[model samples]
Target: MSTTRSTRPPRTLVHPGPSPLSQRWRAGRVLPLVAGLVALVTACPLLFVALEATQSGWDSAERLLGRPLIVTLLWHTVSLAAVVGLATLVLGFGAAWLIERTDLPAKRTWTVLAAMPLAVPEFVHGYCWVSLFPTVQGFWGAALVMTSSLYPLVFLPVAAVLRRSDASTEEVARSLGHGRAAVLWRVTLPQARPALAGGALLVTLYLLGEYGAFAMLRYTTFATAIYTQFETAFDTASASLLALVLVALALLVLLLEGRTARRGGRVVREGSTARPGRPLPLGGWTRPALAAMAALVGTALGVPVYALGYWLVRGSSTTLPSASIWALTATTLGYALTAAAVATAAAVPVALYAWRRDTRLARALERTAYLTRALPGIAVALAVVFFAIRYAQPLYQQPPLLVVGYAVLFFPLALTAVRSSLAQVPHGVEDVARSLGTAPLSVLRRVTLPLILPGLGAAFAMVALTASTELTATLLLAPTGTDTLATQFWTYTTGLAWGAAAPYAAVMTALSVPAVLLLTRRTLGGTRIPREATR
Candidate 1:
């Protein structure tokens, strides 16, 4: 009775569901808006190129397109892409099969070595090879350098798929009287098709956008043509026109890859259990396989290491001021760090929208973000320069401009990592959190961020590694008198001061090793050991 008389203040009703305003903000507007903004930023360079092309009128376009040189460039570009794509496919698939399926000795060591070339940028590879053999400039040279630099893209994914693949289907095929070769050709390769397609797409894209490597090798692809136009002629119209053609080529590759992937589709294992089977005995093939792998490692990883070492040793007497070296290193690190952080952060919204919304608009935005990457870095940098000079004069030759350019060029790398990480996180968890009256930001902070931390770190490291070695963009965008390691290396190399460039190149390579290790570890993390190894 007394308790009843003591009437406490009426409890305020609280809805368990998220507030209507918050729901509208998160479910309806926020992600799409953020994604759109990111997409718009990424599309700026492409838009500028388009605008410049329009302003130049059809006459300039026709004149440029009518040129015999354009045809030559197109042939060269297509040939290079085809050669590199096929070479990478073969090398990557073969290496993955040997390491994952056979009783290859030092599998772990081989795996790491196989992936090590990823640390060396295509430009660096070109520099190494070209420095050793100055005559190495043209199709053969470009193909050799690009294949060595890019094969890891194929190897990593194929190796991963091979490791995780359930061998039951393969065993069944074998029991059905299929030979090892038949099973491998029909069962194994088909299952690995998705990985192969993805890796091939990446290689093709790299060839399309590649400028530094092609430029160093004196190969005249569309990308190199655009760079030459910008540098020599200062003809924005011509460069933009060429860039549009390059974009078309890239889009063509994207379409082909999409169709191939869809046609191939994934092979669904019947059950959740994945049993790693016994490793295939190499027998008489072991020595030959090992020798083959050794040759691959020698070309991809060994050559670059030896080249750098030789340069460093040869340049020991060269007077590279300690202060200047440290300064350049610091500058390179700072720019790379800034670009990495900005790109990784910028990627989150688009990645999140793509992962969660699954709308046409979201898909378009995500695709648009990737479109810039398909453009050469030279094109991207020039577009940024054009935009900065026209609209944002204050940003001209500024570090911020350089950083933004880096983000545009490398955002795809971060997006790929972030989207993949987001895919692994279940949507139901976020829904549960929202139902429990947690705010969207709170859910992200508590559940999402913690879950995707490893992925974010990997993304950051990858973007940083790429930005540090970026040559054309840095050359165009870096503030006057500012020298990053890449620009400094280019200056010395261009001046035929190979010795002076060596220290910078060596340091760049050294810094890249850690990032490469981080990426390889993340890639290989999903791999399970064969039953034989565990035994």
Candidate 2:
């Protein structure tokens, strides 16, 4: 709406117009462009693998595809994904219900302990379990390791929804003479459908690209098979063939997840604080339940911590190649920091555009960011390799290309964090800035940026931690001699040199300690915010 002031010579009122193309151009473009470029580059390796696989004709594809080993690998991969998805869903839903619904003892403590599994990388956990019990080295071992590592993904999201979900509907159902079980199944679980599906999707995708745990546990899934084909057979074609198959599987999981998640509408927390649902009394099972929780925590957290410590102690006495270890650590940190900065910078506009613009284009771009997350690291690395060799041969083996791959692979972490943080800023603040005759850029710099800085930092740190531990892609695309901690740890662990692998794993876990602390602080701070502000 606009008004003309007749007494003031018909003063013109201005309406916000689309930003000019030139104004859209900023150093910010470098981030997404770099991200896009890395995505393309990572796409290359997979492309090469695919080309190699298909170029030999249908005969070769059929021969490779028909092998008993391939069939078993496919079975293992799918089974692991399915089982892990179910496991994570159960853990996520049950934990969320217990913590957010029931009168769980020390709810806050449980919350932190539950989510803390995410801090430990799957590979590290695998190493710990295998070290503790040599028998933990096969399909069952893989499932156990993955369940412990990935249940947190489901737990985090479902917990969030459960915490903020409206309880009135469930109460209403209860008032209608529905039994407790009926009310929960009919009302509560349905409300958590989207979050559960999303979490399951994440778990499935992770299982698809998994290498470390699979390798450590003697489970030869697609990821390990691809690596084996590449390394043992010296046949990138076979690996690419396998990778193509893996990509198809990932895509299928992703699509199914999307449908499941989209079935539920957005959950809204209405009115004032909703009472957390009462925890069902454990009755005589209290001690047993506590023991079960203890066992779960022990397998997931305790074994890993103890094993890493044991190996560190053992490795300390052994002759460690200090120069190599130090160099690898420095390289890992450097790449992580670079990727974090790039990812965080790239996530800003994508998030801001989604938050403020509300256009189809912005929405699509935000979704694109999520696409990379859903894709397996191997697929992304493969694509990057193909793109690099074809277009940027000079970048064929450069560290920059490697860093770019990291950013593309993990940008979603930054995007999600930034989006949540940006959502916290009230639109009224932006309106106030605009009313005060401030430009969009000024408002962004003065108002939005300051408010979201913590979020941006948190995003950067999260990405940094993830990038540092990324194994499969880093193994495939890292420069000829660059040894990341993940790759180093994998090499030693695979060689059955537990003592040597321990140092790298310990250092990696040790490096993540600060990040875990920061995340805990953030979690507590977010939870402690006024209930209204949380809304």
User: Highest TM-score, which number?
Assistant: 1
Give lDDT tens digits, candidate 1, residues 366-417.
Answer: 7777677778888889888878988899999889999999989999889887
lDDT of 2 by residue, 453-507 (tens): 9889879988998998898889888999778999888877766778888878877
Off by over 4 Å in 1: 1-27, 265-271, 316-323, 527-535
Model 2 deviation from the true structure expressed as Cα RMSD, one decimal place: 6.0
Model 2: lowest-lDDT 10 consecutive positions: 526-535
| TM-score quality measure for candidate 2 | 0.82
Q: Name the best candidate (by lDDT).
A: 1
